[model samples]
Target: MTERDFDEIAALALKHTGIVLGRHKANMVYGRIARRLRQTGYRNFADYLEYLKDNFRDESTNFINLITTNLTSFYRESHHFDFLRDTVIPELKKKSDKKVRIWSSGCSIGQEAYTIAFTLAEAHMASAFDVKILATDLDSNVVSTGAEGVYPADSLMSVPDDAVEKFFEKNRTGNQVRVKKSIRDLVHFKRLNLLEGWPMKGKFDVIFCRNVVIYFNRETQKTLFNRYADYLPVGGYLIIGHSESLNGLTDRFKSLGNTIYQKIY
Candidate 1:
């Protein structure tokens, strides 16, 4: 792709998704766009760009899904789940409402959300307390997949055998497993653009926006962080990715180490 071509595509991505696609991502972007070209029956980048501009109303979703990265796995960041089990749940148990809400913002394909469900199930929360996990992503494709709650059998390699048996049922092919109804019921998957307005009416007890802000600029990060703060009450939790930090961005939260932050003000 020419420099001009990459610039236009990057600009369009930023406009729609608030994701920064620096020149360094040119090759990766080119590859994904090529897949789009093949799917859309376009002959070249320039032609695809022209078609995209005219058909944006119909194609913008595909463009955004192509540009956005969705890299996630069950217990991908195990420590976060550990903290949820060891700290967050116990704290919630003490509350009188007996209701718990956790959001997996930018949740790719529901692994993280399902992992939270597994933790809750292990703790007997399904029968003892009211629980809900909202798993949302910008990619509608992944959102649908998450709602199906089926995954490759090998994806559970990191999970212990007993837990896997308890949480998922092996399909006839044995190559895939579907999350058990009891576990899948805890999560609700939807397509959401973080840059757009959120429709959720209630504050989440914990928000897992892991690895999502790394694609946004500092200014966007600042806006998004404060927006998250607005959705959380004081002492509510915000858990981010391993590589992200809130320092110099916002002071609404106090770092509790391990990339966990508690809303303090």
Candidate 2:
């Protein structure tokens, strides 16, 4: 693909999703989107670009899905779940009205959300408080998969053994597992673009965004973190990816280490 063609596609992605595609991704973009060209009967990137202008309203959805990376696994960042179980949820129950809210902002396929729910269940908060976990992702496809709550059996490797035994049922082949009703009932999945406005009404006790902002520009990161702070009350928790830190990004949260932060002000 030519630089001009790559630039146009990148610009569209950034404008619509707030995700920046560096020049280095040009080859990767071409490789992934080439199938769309074949399906649409376009012979080249230039033709595809021209075609997308008129059809982007519909095609952009698919394009965004193809471009946005959805790399997640059950408790991929195990420490965050440990903190939730060991510390956060207990503290939240101590202060709240016997109801707690947690958001998995870039929830991807719901592992994090389910993990959070299972952690709370293990903590026995279900005995006292009603817990709600909202799992959201920009890609609707993954959102639907998360809602379905079925995954490859191997996906449970990182899940604590007790959780797997309690929360999932193996399918006939035992090659797939589906989340049980009790755990599934705790989470609600929705399609949300972080760059856009959020529709959630109540503030959350904890927000797990994790690894989502690495694709966004610094300015967008600042704006998004500020927005996250707005959704959290004083002392509410925010857990981002291990590689991410809020040090110079925003003063909205103070570091609790291990990429965890607390809304201090």
Candidate 3:
């Protein structure tokens, strides 16, 4: 691909997905876009770029799905869930009505959302509380797969044996597992581009946007956190990846242990 072709694809991605492609990322862009070219039956990269520009809506959606990286697992960063179970949930239960709302932003393939639901159900709060988890992802493919709630057995390796036996059914046909209906019903997955204005309504008691902002530029991170602050109530929890920090971003949150932040409004 020519330099101009890479620049155009990167610009289109940044415009639609808010993902910035640095100078060294040209090869990455080529590898991803090349697949899209073959899928669309385009002759070359230049033809694919032109098609994307002409057929903005459909191609843009496909491009977003192709370029977005979705790497997630059940109970990733286990400590955050532990903190939620031991600290946040107990406190919320004491002061509030038995209703809880959580937004799992950038929840790739639904593992994190399911993990949240499993934790709540294990805590025996499923029937007592009005629990709902909203999971969103930029990639349509991952969002649909997550909604299906099927996985390979390897994906359940980290899940406790009891929980796995209780919540997932093993598929004999091919090393597959399906999340039980009880757990699947608790989450709602949607396609959300974090760069655009949020369309969700109501504030959440907790928001899990872990590991997403690390791919964005610092300015994007600041804006994303500000938006998270806007959507959370005072003392609501914001759980980020362990490798991430808000140190240079904003002061609206006070650090809680285990990579969790409490909105201090």
Candidate 4:
């Protein structure tokens, strides 16, 4: 891929999805999207760029799918689940509405959402309330995979061992596992571009937006953090990626440590 071609692709990704791609990401971008060149029979990135200009609809979706990083697993950053099981769920249970509403923003491949599902199940919170999880990502491919609820059986290892039998059923191949219908029913996966207006209605009690904003610039992060605050009511919680912080980003939330925050009116 030529440097000029790479620059064009980078610009397209940012324009469509709000994911910032710095010079350092050039190599990673090339590695991720080279398969597109091969599949489309384009001899080089230059040829692919020409096609992308005319086929932006089909190509951009595939481009974003290929370029965006989607590294996620069940109960990734496990302690967050501990807090949910031990603290958050119990508190939400006592509320007058008897509802549990969670938004797993950037819920790649559904493991994080499933982990939320299993944790709520273990706490006996899944069926008791009108529970719902909104799992969204800009990439439609990952959203489809998440909604399908199938994964390598070994991914079950990321959560408590007991959770495997409770929430997932093995595929006929026995090498793969799919989330049980009960758990799957709890999550609703959709295609969402965070930079665009959200179509969702109503507030969320707890939002898990981990590892999603590291690719965005500060201004974008600030806007997003503020939007998150709007989606949450006073005392609602927001869980971010361990590497991310809200320090100096916004004052809408109070730090509860370990990258957790609570809305403070």
64-171, model 3: which lDDT tens digit per residue?
887788889999999988988998778767756677899999999999999999988888877788889999999999999999999998998889999998889888
Return the candidate ranking by TM-score, descending. Answer: 1, 4, 2, 3
Error of model 4, residue 97, in angstroms? 1.4
Instruction: For each candidate in the order shown, give its overall lDDT on alpha carbons.
Output: 0.93, 0.89, 0.88, 0.90
Work out the TM-score per prediction.
0.98, 0.96, 0.96, 0.97
Give the per-residue lDDT of model 2 (tens digit) for 63-120: 8887888899988889888899889876876874787899999888999899888888
Tens-place lDDT per residue, model 1, 8-110, is 9999999889899999999999999999999989989999999899999999999999998998899878999999999989998897999899999999988
Taking all chains together, the TM-score of candidate 4 against the true structure is 0.97
Alpha-carbon lDDT of model 2: 0.89
Model 3 segments more than 4 A misplaced: none
Predicted candidate 1, C-alpha RMSD: 0.8
Q: Find the 10 residues in a row with the least total lDDT in model 1.
A: 156-165
Cα deviation in Å at residue 5, candidate 2? 1.1
Q: Model 3, residue 197: what's the lDDT? A: 73
lDDT of 4 by residue, 130-174 (tens): 999999998889999999999887777776668887887897889
Best by TM-score: 1
For model 2, give the RMSD to the true fold: 1.2
